[model samples]
Target: MASIDSKVNLSTIPLVALNVTVRKKLGLYLNPKNIMGFSYLEITNFENFKNPTNEILKNWQAQRSEASVGKLLSILTEAERTDVVEDLRALIDEDVRKYIAFMEKKEDPPVQVPEVDSCVPRTPETLGLTVLDDPDGLYPERFDAFICYCQSDFPFVHEMIRELEQTDYKLKLCVFDRDVLPGSCVWTITSELIEKRCKRMVAVVSDEYLESDACDFQTKFALSLCPGARSKRLIPVIYKPMTKSFPSILRFLTVCDFTRPCTQSWFWVRLAKALSLP
Candidate 1:
């Protein structure tokens, strides 16, 4: 039996990870927000680990130190704790590698005395895009995140939009559906509109979603637009059981599953964290 002090300590896990078998056997009662979701920890780490680089492994070690694994395990069952911890460690490793890469690029010598060519006619507007960026969201202009999916997947997209909207994440999700453009413009304007807008995209993976080429392209474009093209920015919401495999591009993202509600509450808590909401 876990005591109040134990519960408090478990709940205080720096990173959110719930043990399934432990919860089943011990009847752990955690705040609903702390539920777990599919993460990039395993998939991402496996992708990077295969290459076996000293620097990558070192970065993983650093991120692991940021969170307490033992405290994390004490909160869940043996099995759950082990699985979650291992996965979390993998993701931390990937992040560390990315950080190192970024720093290295920053430290590299700057090219000088190089002649620059202007291919196309440029104006202040083109230059203004990079002008003093606001820390707060783009002031009724740009978005920090954008949820994009096929029109067929509107319901799922809508639900996710609603959930995110309720949180404090400072981004406007341009959810495109029949509702956005009801009439004749639906077919003619969808592709142009979706591609032109949306900075970060969330692809809702479903049976119907894969069946459409339009959707495939949209997800692809969104993935391309992602900064550094890291996996987390473009989300994949797994709506059902699947044998499908994502490309290396998307392999690193945390898959948000709607399959098991009971086990999925912690994912929402991470979403809350991503949203930067209390």
Candidate 2:
């Protein structure tokens, strides 16, 4: 167990059944906002060299992925949560060491781009879109599909969108926090886009998205549209194979696997097929 002041060490304390108060006493400070659906009591025993319980192993395996572990570490690093990061690295499996190293290598130094000060503020008006504050969410035009994803999946989504754009797909992508205009009510815009205007929802499924409240909400809402996975409208692109126990919502859905090497043409072919793009 890692010690804080030689007074409270994690080794002596059993993490398996500790509540938030007990975890706080043990110096484990997990952000409540970030760990919304998680029960802190399910921690793996790190003192003894024995294999963890199946439930603990399952949870840990979920956290082992690029989206889960990687995203958490990135958030911690941004927030300067070094203590938690160090303790977590120590507690994690050996396979995670490489992932952490990869994350470190991927970290780019911040570029000092010059900011241009503009008197005119940017808004939906600039984009020629009328901002209607409709509680019932009545939108005029409908898109072919709305993308439900995490920011970490942006690069892949961007590339996929670019590829689709090159062809005759003319996909109108509704990626929140990116495609949406600034200063608009996020909830309102999201409801309008996904619920009202979008004919289909394309989920870029990964551990990060699965853990996110916003992404999960979008997925469930889309799932409600179709009775099951057979709905061609609700498409799932497997950005990464989840180690976590499969969510009931996506269990029966056919996914386009983009988990393999991107250099291969198969991903594009399969994706085009999934989207029904000629």
TM-score for each predicted model, relative to the true structure: 0.40, 0.46
The alpha-carbon deviation from the true structure for residue 82 of candidate 1, after best TM-score superposition, in angstroms, is 62
Candidate with top TM-score is 2
Pick by lDDT: which candidate is best? 2
Deviation of model 2 at 165, angstroms: 1.7
- The segments of candidate 1 whose C-alpha lies over 4 angstroms from its true place after superposition are 1-140, 167-171, 178-197, 243-249, 275-278
- Candidate 2 to truth, TM: 0.46
Clashes per prediction?
7, 1
Q: Write one digit per residue (lDDT tens) for candidate 2, span 134-195.
A: 11111133456788888888898888777664455445556565555566565556656766
lDDT of each: 0.45, 0.54
| Per-residue alpha-carbon lDDT of candidate 1 for residues 1-278, written as tens digits (9 for 90 to 100) | 11223333332232213222332322223322132222446434323321222212223333454433344454444435555444344443343344445446758946873656654322222221211211121211234345546666777666665566544433345565422424333333333334443345566776677677767777776666555555345666775565655445566677667777776777655553553321
Show the colliding residue pairs in model 2.
Answer: 1-11
